[model samples]
Target: MSTLRTLFLSPRVTATGHALADAARRRGARVETLREWRVPEQQRRAEGSSLYAGPLFADAVARELGLGLLEAPQDWLARLPRELTLRDVEFGTIAEAWRLRRPAFVKPPNDKSFPARVYPDGSGLPGPDAVDGTEPVLVSDIVTFAVEFRLFLLNGEVRTASRYATRGALDVAPLERDPRRAEVLAFAERLAGTGLPSAVVVDVGLVDDAGWAVVEANAAWASGHYACDADAALDVVLHAARPEGEFGAADRRFLRPAPEVVRD
Candidate 1:
């Protein structure tokens, strides 16, 4: 009976955002889609120099979409707002960071962060200049994890959870251990203690064969859509909408609103 305005961000249509958009349409709510980065006309003209252009375009996209920006704080480079959450590992100094144990992880602290290439805890990945050596960088003890889990959060509540055995980019397998399963779910719950955005994914992994650790929180927009259950994932996402059939067609959907007209 009420109308709401929602904005979803993703480089491309993703499962989480798609479901949310579907729900919103069914509920008669308006939804808009935006990307993390949008290259400008002039910049794109250069052709071969778009590698470092993500941030520049992403900033523009944030303005166009009228939504708060997200970033991972692991590197001093992310340049996030102070009030935004900072990762524990994104410490300012390597001297200070030495306090952390080896075999932990060093990753970006925010959602928009491109995943940092992980380095072993004490393997001298950084070399002599590692800490005092270079500009501000994100570093953490490599997590000697026993298990990893990905949990979905819809409007601040847990929707569904899945366990993983990851060895690299594509080797993700469903977890087979009860303790690993139990730990991942539990970690997801703990992260909810901190306030998070409306639609997001809470990824948790283990550290040092001991306690469960926070991997990195991600926006449903940019992250993978469905790894565990597609329909269930959609249900949680579409909960905010009206009914399912209001949109023109379920398969080809458009949530991006028409541009406003000028009064002049």
Candidate 2:
């Protein structure tokens, strides 16, 4: 294979892309730095398009250069190929806001963690939490972020997994495997051919009490790299960029022998 040329699509002083690029380069790959690329202001005005012009540019470049695309997590990532944002909430009058359920939240849909209090609690505290209650902000039902899982993807395939800690940092090994991790992996398998971008990290969170719900999917744009096996992730990158061979859609059978329950 020709020397793999990678162009890092991010701003300067970024630790995420820098680390990955360094790893890829030391492994005999030629990497490029494309810090100039970012989502333009005008592209936001496009009508009814799910694709963001900025990341889409990287997606194209990755295709051309045979490089992989990694991105940070964000609202847009949850709505891939649709340019849909998890923002844009249904705001209501003061009366309606008062009528919100006990655990229901009154936060800007744009905010990731809800409550915005000194902590996510009833005591709306010192800062942004006290913003105008009547402003056209977002409100949503609050779900407990019990332990979270971050499944790294190279191209569209999943690499090894880890947990997303409270400080937004990646955690290596934690006690007790996620109860619903098995189901989450199954969900990822369903998207095996959905044309998701290469070099991406998928964050699948569980809904409170719901079995293995997709909290949100993210592009690798602003994602963190913790315990991500560079070699394994890179392999996914190389495989996705190559010409796809003709394969049967239903060729692989899952039901041949599924996993059995662990009887204690």
Candidate 3:
């Protein structure tokens, strides 16, 4: 039986959220769409509760309810072998990225703190006045993928997957229909021991002439389902966000840092 008794959703429920909510209902779990940052008084004491939302909002709710949300380490991608990433990637601060003399793909590792795109050069990045100089970001060589897939992983195995794009455009399709499905799964299995949270999203793509390479890793709580099976994706979400008391020893290392609450 699933331990999830109630699932909290963002106030503005997205198509993905709706799908997960529906799946939760089938599992006999209550769903609540929060209208604000505050947790409802009644749910404050609810047990077996979890959340699915964006990073900032999810962080706030997790802190309020003492839930442990798991995510990849901020430097996970940058630390991966170049053989896996298929490009040179570095973990550095926004200020450091500003010193780049050549075009590079830059993005925040765990949050949407800044736009993730290929900047012409250092001058094209956001100014220090706009973003903190010390904020962590990933800078990598530019690579184009001909096809991209999202895999929902749980317990070091891919529970579900979907082809989310082709040639940088939206093109959702079931992984079962793809001819290269086995290759994709094989690549994901190779990443199983890479220290990611048990439940997380891994995107892999076929670089134009580079074969398959990892695009990035995302928190299951914040990733889109695309064409994935909602039930399987929900399993990942439940594992990703659980009561702090339910976390195993290994899970502790992957917990996302609690966001500091701002008092009015």
C-alpha TM-score for every candidate: 0.49, 0.46, 0.97
Ranking by TM-score: 3, 1, 2
lDDT of each: 0.43, 0.42, 0.89
lDDT digits (tens) for residues 121-189 of candidate 1: 534334455334333346643444455566667755667666654543333434333446655555555
Clashing pairs in 3: none
Off-target runs (Cα >4 Å) in candidate 2 are 1-3, 34-140, 154-156, 166-184, 190-199, 235-264
Specify the poorest-scoring 10-residue window by lDDT in model 1: 45-54
Clashes of 2: 13
* Candidate of highest lDDT: 3
Report how far off residue 53 is in candidate 3 (Å): 0.4
User: After TM-score superposition, what is the CA distance of residue 32 in candidate 3 from its true location, in Å?
Assistant: 0.2
Which structure among the candidates has the greatest TM-score? 3
User: What does the lDDT come to for candidate 2?
Assistant: 0.42
